[model samples]
Structures are given as C-alpha cells and as structure tokens.
Target: RIYVFYGPHGCGKSTFLNNLLTRFEDYANTEEGLRYEVVWRLNIKKLKGTNKSAMSLSAFEKLIQVIDPENEGKHDLEGKDLAFDDKEQEYIEVPCLCHDNPFLVIPKDQRRNVLDELIKNDEFKWKLFTEKQYEWVFKEEVCTICSSIYQSLLERLGSPSEVFSMLYARPYYFNRRIGNGISVFNPGDKPLRRNFILNQMLQSRINALFQDSNVINYLYSSFAKVHNGIYALMDVKSHNVERMVELHNIISEGVHKVENLEERVDCLFFALMNPEDKRNLREFPSFEDRIQYIDIPYVLDVNTEVKIYMDIFGRHIEGSFLPMVLENFARAIICTRLGKKSGAMEEWIKDPKKYQNFCDDDLILLKMEIFSGVVPKWLEDSDVKALDKKMLKKIITESEIYGKEGLSGRDSIKIFDQFYSKYAKEDRLISMPDLCTFFKKLGDQPKKIIPQGFLSSLLRMYDYSILQQVKESLYYYNEEQIGKDIKNYISAVTNEFNSVIRCIFTKEEIYVTEAFLESIENRLLAENADPTRRKEMREEVLKKYTTLTLTQEIMIEGKDISETRLFQSLYDRYVHNLKKRVLEPFVANENFRNAIKDFDTEKFKTHDRRIKRDVTFLMENLSRKFGYTQQGANEVCIYVIDNDLANKFKNA
Candidate 1:
C-alpha cells in the first residue's frame, strides 16, 4: 500500500510516523506469529540511479579478491577447489540490499506445499490462505538471485531434502545506523556507488556444494534492502520528486526492472508531503490513483493541544495559571486554525446571537469543545436533541477542511513561550485578564490572523463563567426551606388566595396569600413580568398540579411532590436565580472586597465575625468544589467584584 501523509509543515507528521514505527516494532516483538517484517525508512532523495551486474563466476572471483586483499584465496581454483584463508570466520561484509529472507530462498513452486506441511495451526493456515493482506506470502515468488541459487543447489544434490538442509533461518537485527533492517535516509546523504556485494566464506561454501552448477554469485540493487518491508519517504520534494517518478512501475505492478532482471518488491510504501509539495507529483498525473493521500491537519482539539504544551513545557507549568486559563490559551490558538464560518454549525444553530453568553458569533469555541469530545452543557435542550448521528457526522467531517490555515504548530509554541514568560508570576496566579492582555497587545499584523470579534466574545464568555462560579461558591441557601417554599407555592397556586393550609411535603403551616405566591413566582418568572403574565404563570402551574403532580404523584404512585419532574424543573430555576443574586450584597460592601484581598493575612483576624465567616466559607468552597488554589480563589473573587460582573451579566 502506498500512503502519502500530506499536511502543513511542523504539524507533527514526522512525530506521528516515529510513534507508529515504535508501536509496530513493539507489536512485532511481542507477537511471535506476526506475518510482517521490519519497516525500512528510506529517504527517496538519497536514492541514486539503478545499477546491475551479471551473476557469473567471474563476479565471485572479483568479490573474493575484494574480501581477501592479502591474496589468501586461490585465484586459479574453480568450483569445489575454490578455497580462502580463515574460511571458518564470517568476517566478510554483505550489502543489506542483497540479503533475502530464508523463506524466500525456497523455490516458488514448492514453497506453499512446504509451508502447509510445516505449520500445524489450522487458524493460522486459514488466515494465510484466505486473508487479503497475507496473500503475498503464498503468491510472491523468490527474487531472481535466490531462485538461481536454489535451483543450482537442487540440481547438484538431486535431493530436495539435501538442498533444503543448507538453508537456515536467523533473527534479523534491525539497526538504523548501518542500514541493516531499519534504515533512515536523509536528503543530505550521498547515494552509494557500489552495487555489488559478496561474502567470501559463504561463496566458498556454496561453490563446494554446487561445483557443476552455473550459479556462483548474485547481483545487488538498492531496492532489495526494503523488499517485503516498509519504504518511508521523508518528504516528496527536492530529489525525491525524481525518485517517486522512478517508482511508477514498482508501485503499479509490484516489480522493478534492473538491467535484464525483474525484482519483486512487496513493500508498504509511505511518504510525508507538505500541502505545497503536492505539486511535485503533478508531472506524473497517473500517480494520483496509485498513491493514497492521508490528511494530517493542524491540532483542532483544545485538550490535545494543551497536552502538547504540557509535554513540551512540563505539566507543572499548569500550576502557574488559574484554572481553565491555560486551556483558554490553547483554545485561543486553536480558534486561529478554524474557519470563521461553519455550515454545519449554522445548520444546527440558525441564530448564534441566542448563545452570546456561552459561544462566539462564529461558533469556533463550540466547535473546539466538540472536537475535544465534549458536548457543552450550555447548549439549548432543543439544539442538543437535534444533534442526531447524521448531523454529528457532518460536523466531524467538516474538521478535515479546517486546521489547514491559521497558526501552524510551530507558530503556536513560539507564541505560547512569549505569553507564558510575560504572565506567569510568583506573586499571583495568571488570570483571564492576563490572557486577554497578551493577545490584545499583539501588533496589528499578527492580530489579523485571529478572527475579528473573537477576543471580545471570549472575554465576555469568560466573565460570565467566572461570575457564575463566584456566585455558586458564595451561595449557602437552606435546601429544606427552599423545598418548603416550592411546596407552599404549588399548594397556594392550586387553592384560592387568602386561604390558610398546612404543607403536606414539609409538614409546615402556611398562610397562603397573593404576596406568598408572588415571592416564589418572582424567582421562577422574569422580573419585568406584568400582573397578567404572573397570573398566567400561576394558572400554568396550577394546571400542571391538577393534571400530573396532584393526581399521579400524590394519589396514583404515592411519591413525594418534590420527586416529580415538574417540581425538579422549577427547583433548578429557583436555585439558579438565588445564586445569581448571592453576590449582590457583598459586591456593595467595601469590607467584603477588602476581606477577600486580605484573606490568609493577619488583618483577616480583625474583621467582624459574620463577615469573616462568610469569606472563609466562600474561599473554602471555591477550593473544594472547583480545582482552585487559595491564591486562585482570592484572585477570581476580587476580579468578579471589581469588574461589576454581577451587574454585567445580571440578565444573563
């Protein structure tokens, strides 16, 4: 299979390839029955023109002279009489390209029968025969050189068993340094000139066994090194463009012509190309179908981008920034990589203005969350229900076209270094203000890369989120009293006004009146709701009580009224409104603002008992509920109060 991974440069294409190689090696080592061989990484730019030689006795004589420079081998000897000094030692060098697998040394006609007799496992035999990926094992014939040697040895011995005994199997050691099994070629590496390879000891042994046969030596070529293995081209530019053109036949027909012989190359061909480098293959239009191009786009997932930062800068760097601030930085960088408008998003959300408090106008932030495998809770229930399987698939498919533009991976890292160095401090944790300031301070040229109005929307969203966090942390309402209030309101709405009744759920006495119903209704309904709207809301609640809550919950199932779905929905809104107003009184108090700043200091001990207790409880809950440090809690609280965030998002 020929696969070309094309993407923008510095987007971790090479890193992904290296990790894949490591995984393949680990899997092959652990699994003894794996059918694949070692992957050989090759830089096509380093490959030179092909050269071939004849497989004659004179070639072996020339090879013997090269290995035995001291004239240790008999020059006039032929066949069995050919002898060399130190014949027992295997010190002769053989080119890795000339090496062949022991299984390939067998004759093609009898190889399958031999394997069927040897392998006892039925499942493995079934796979080897039936699986498409393993078809090469039985279909591929031996190389021209191995076939010649096997035929010659068989003719001399006249026995298949005797000839097969000479062939032995050994472990293949993949060393990258010497280009043994795994070799990585670079653009700068010079191509080898010498194509002939010989080992004197092995040649002498072969000559003694096959004295009358014509086969004496075999020719070598560069392609043999990666035969039946992986051939990875680093990039398809520069000299590699020519090399890719040269592999047209090998890629199409699984064979390469070397002089008079055809070499069979069953290899997994892989290459990495930049988006611009794709033009290099334009001259050969036929390659479009032969090569499979896999898109390796920029990092769109915010969490994965943060993990990349943590990997480079260390995980401890997260402690320097406030919670979600570091991720927000990553989110900002990823937003630059996304398209400004999304058809899928627009199709799903017809109006982006409705979610101004949660998402940006472009919905890039929402898309980033989805890319990170998160369905944000802020999405409207109707929109959430509309996210069926087909709609989700369209959204995910749109990601392929994005992450191609905007800030590259290298650019993001450099920008993060600058941002971190400026804001990370020892006195206080980094906050949203620092993040906003860093991007705002950039020059106009760099700012043009970011989508317009995104920063303002991001700041608005951050402000709204932190305000809710502060409100939740400060809220200490009584759950039992709130439940009683709801039950009393439901009972009052169902009955006539000015009537006195005892609550069934809370077992508390209540004097039902218009003011009593208005108090709870004020929290559940809009503040500006007119008298008629309030009356309509009361009637709606009463209708629900008579139809579902009163008849089914109380009489049919005998479940508490609070356990009904209608009650839970109202309870959520009541609590949300209460938390929204929890920080109102404290924001107006100057002592509360000073107390948050003076927290953990000696001055905090002198504050009034009630004020001190409230501050302490807020800070503790901020740390316990949210993953905030003491310093982070103090900073967020001060930020919310000083910015008048309560009033800023009062309607939200």
Candidate 2:
C-alpha cells in the first residue's frame, strides 16, 4: 500500500516520518516485535575436492575480495578449504535477501503439506505464534532471486531435513540504515533496478551450480531492499511518468514487473509531496485510487508548537529560564496561521451564537486549549464535552485551512535563536521585554508571514495577561471556596424554611420558622432601611418567597433564582455589606498592611485591635461568602505583601 502525505511545505511532514521511525525502533526493542529470518550455513570441510569453492557465487564476490584481496580471482585453496578463514574455522553463512521466513522457502503449493513437519520441532512451537499471525507473516513468497538460490540448494541437498540442518532461523529486526527491510527512494535520473554483488569466495561454487554468469542473485533497488517492509519516496511527483506507472502497478497489483520477472512485494509504500506536487499528481488518475493520502499540516496548537520549541531548545537552558512569555511568541505565530472559522465549524460547535461571541483571541485560546485536551470555560455546560475526542477531532478537521498559512516551525526556531543570542550575550535573562523587542523587529520585516493584525492582537493579549497576573498576585486569597460556602449557607437556610412554610400553605399542619425568616430579612436590609421600612420589607419578602415556591418550579441560572427577585437582591446586599465591612477597612488602614507585612497573626492582634477584628472578619467573609479556609486566606494575604503586588498594580 502507498501512503502519500500531501500538504504545504514546512508542515512537519518529514518530522512525522522521523517520529514514525522512532516509534518503530521502540517497538523493535520489544520482545514480540522480533520477527525471524533464515540464514544458510555451509560446512567448509565437506566440499574439499568438490567443484564448489568459496568464490562460486556473485553475491560473495565483493566480500571475498575485501577479506582475501591478495588472492585476486584465483585461489590456491581447494573446495571446502577455500571458505575456511584460518582465524575462525567456521562454515560460511549467507543471510536471506528479504529477511524471508524459513518456512516461506518451501514452494507455496507444497507449504500446506509441509506445515506440520516444519513445526514438529519444539523450537517451532505453535505457542510462539497464533495461526493467523503465522499465516500473514510467513505467507509472502521469497524474492525471485532468493527463490532460485533456495531451489538450487534444495536440489543439491536432496531432502528437507538435510537443507534444514544446513540452515538456521533466528529473529531479525528491521533497520532503515542496513536496508534489510526499510528503503527510501529519492528522485534521480535513472529508473530503479535490482542489483546483486557476488562474493568472490562463493563465486566459483555458485557459478558451477547455475547456468547464468551472474551466479548469486541479490535484489538491490529501493523497492527490492524493502521487499517485505517499508519503502519511502520523497517528492514522488517529481519522477517521470514511466516510474510513476511502475509505482502505480506495484501498489495496485502488488507486483513489480521487470523484463520476464514478476516479483511479488509485501512492502508498505509511503510517498511525500507538497501541495503543488499533489496538484500535478492529477495527471495520473489511476495512481490516485491506489494511494492513501494523509495531510501533515503545521502545528496550529499553541501548546504543541511550544512543545516543539521546548523539545528542540529547552534542554540547553537553565532551570525555568524559558518564561511563560515564550508561549506568547508561539501563540502569536499560531494566530497568524489561523483563518476565520467556516460555517461548517460553527455547526459543530454546541451553540453557533456562542462561538460567534468569542473574539479572535478567545477563539484562539479555546482552540489551543481544545488541542491540548483541556476544556475551556465556554464549553463547561455545552453539549460537546471536552472528553469527546471524536468531536474535538472533527473541529480540528474543519479548521485544517488554518495550519497551512502560519510561519513554518523552522522560521519560529530561527527567530527564537536570534532572540536568545541577543539577550544571552548581554548576560540578561530572556525576559518578556526582550521577547517583545524581537517580535516588533520580526513584524517590521518586509513580506514576512506574521500578519500585522496577529502581532497587535497577540501583544494586547499579553498585556492583559500580565495585568491579570498582577491582580492575582495582589488578591492572592482564594475567594472561590468562600463564594461556595456563602451559596451553600443560603441554600440550606432557604430550603429549611421553605419546607416548614409548605405545610402551612397546604393547611395540613401550620408551622412558621419566624426566626430564620427574620434572620434572612436582617441580612438583606441596607444600612438606610429604618425600623418601619424594614418591617414592610420583611412582610413583602415572606409574601413573595412563600407564593412562588408553592406555585412554581424554579430553574436557577448563574446567581439568579427564579422563585423570587428578593433572593437575588438579598444575596447582592449581603455581598455588598461584606465588601464594605471587610475590604474597605483593609485597604484604608495602615495596621492591615502591617498584619500582611509578614502575615504575623500574633503581631496583627497586638498592633491594632480594630484592624485585627476587621482582618478576621475579612477571612470569615471569604470563608462564608466564597469558601476559603482560614489557612488559605492567610496564605493569600501573605503572598500579596511578600510579592509587593500592591506596588505593581498601584498605577494601573
């Protein structure tokens, strides 16, 4: 099968292949990934006087010259003694050309009959392989040349047992460099052909056994080298029509025809082409159907692009040297690559109107988070949950046009190098200011891919981000838990009173929890609400709260309750009171500053009783209103002072 990765240049097509090679290498390291190949061994002592000599085969011709070059074509040693290397008096070993399985050497028609005999040995036990796996892997026929060699050996040896004894089968791992089962075909002047080199030591013996002068048959083209594995073709469309036809034939028919030989191939073929090359490929319609096309586009994901940068350069930097600002650079480049979302994309979104509401920055942030497998705030209650991998994939597919236009990963790396070199030379850390200076220069360059709008928008997002950090640094207290506690208390008291009021409304058993009602009324009242007005307000709250619960089914949205308007107004009033009673005093009082100066609770208590009381009230308010624990509140106050957050955001 031929797989073509077609896309624009710099879209990481080559990176994808490199990653695949790495993955296969990892798999080959595993026990189960070890497949077997056959090797023939010849007893050097047995053929002493026979016509067979070490230089008999064409394949051994070169190895012999390299090992025993001084002997030239002729050697004084006779037959079996000719192959004996005085250093190691062992039999000659010849590996199979295609990593051909031992059982596959048997003729296809006779394989079924010989299967039981082949596996009879404990070494070839069925437990090592399942029936289907055995069949799929071993079913391929040996290469034409190897088949000829094996047949000649079988005839010379006389029996299967004799041939088996003269051979060994062991695990073989596929390696691209060795060309055992992996080959890459690059465009060149001449068409690909099978080649064989004769080992001089085996040439004489192999020549005597075969009629052809080309004694040893070893196939050597990119196709032949990867006979049973993988074949990669870079820029395949650049090749001539004849080569294209050959590729088409091999892929569709699973055979390569050269002269009289119809060689069967069990290789996975991969072809890479840029978008323009793919456009030219239309000339060959038949080839189109035979190839599976995959698009290897640029990294549209901010995190993934950042990771690519980090993986390539992060190791060189010291601990935490690469600040969050580096991610801003990545996001800017990614934003340039993104096009506006299509109507098709909108349809996939849970709410098209909701998607429309997002600014480009928000969209980019959401898309980046989605790509990184994180659900954004906008999607929390939406129909398409973050865990829906399929829908997320669909969104990516719909936005494929985005990745085609960005600055290439290579360009980004170049900019990163330039920036690092500039700052690191001056003995300064790679700060956000340094990054911005470099970015401005990049944007100013003529005909650069970084769009003006993209740069400006990214900078805006960066400034906002910095401001947010400043705010978080100042209000370091965890208000989230405090807010939760407030809501929970309101829910508990309201539900308890509602349950008692329900029986009175039904007239079955009258019961009124006046204490709870009055407590809630007091909290809801403003400072200006006098005694007379407070009494009226309390009566109005009871009337509305009881009437709605008894008649309506309320559906709450955000902080609003549908049961009664007073609930929302009351909650707001309590929050306002909390902010005024706690927040104002802390900001206005000098003692509050001293309390947070080192977060010394004992000193805070002694410094000013009024400030201490207000500080305690603030923590309780946060715990009661938001849900922060005492320790959490204290930590927040301490961080704010320790970091000098007030000064950072003082002007802003």
User: Cα lDDT for residue 366, model 2?
Assistant: 57
- Any runs in candidate 1 off by more than 4 Å, and if so which? 31-129, 142-149, 156-159, 162-168, 172-181, 194-205, 212-218, 258-261, 487-512, 526-529, 539-564
lDDT of 1: 0.76
lDDT of 1 by residue, 26-62 (tens): 5544547243222122111211112111112355655
Candidate 2 runs further than 4 Å off: 44-91, 109-134, 185-201, 209-222, 237-246, 257-262, 279-283, 316-323, 344-362, 378-394, 423-438, 444-488, 491-652
lDDT of 2 by residue, 393-499 (tens): 77767676667776777777787677666776323345455566777776444226554454555544444444333233233333454343334434434344445
Top-TM-score candidate index? 1
TM-score of 2: 0.66
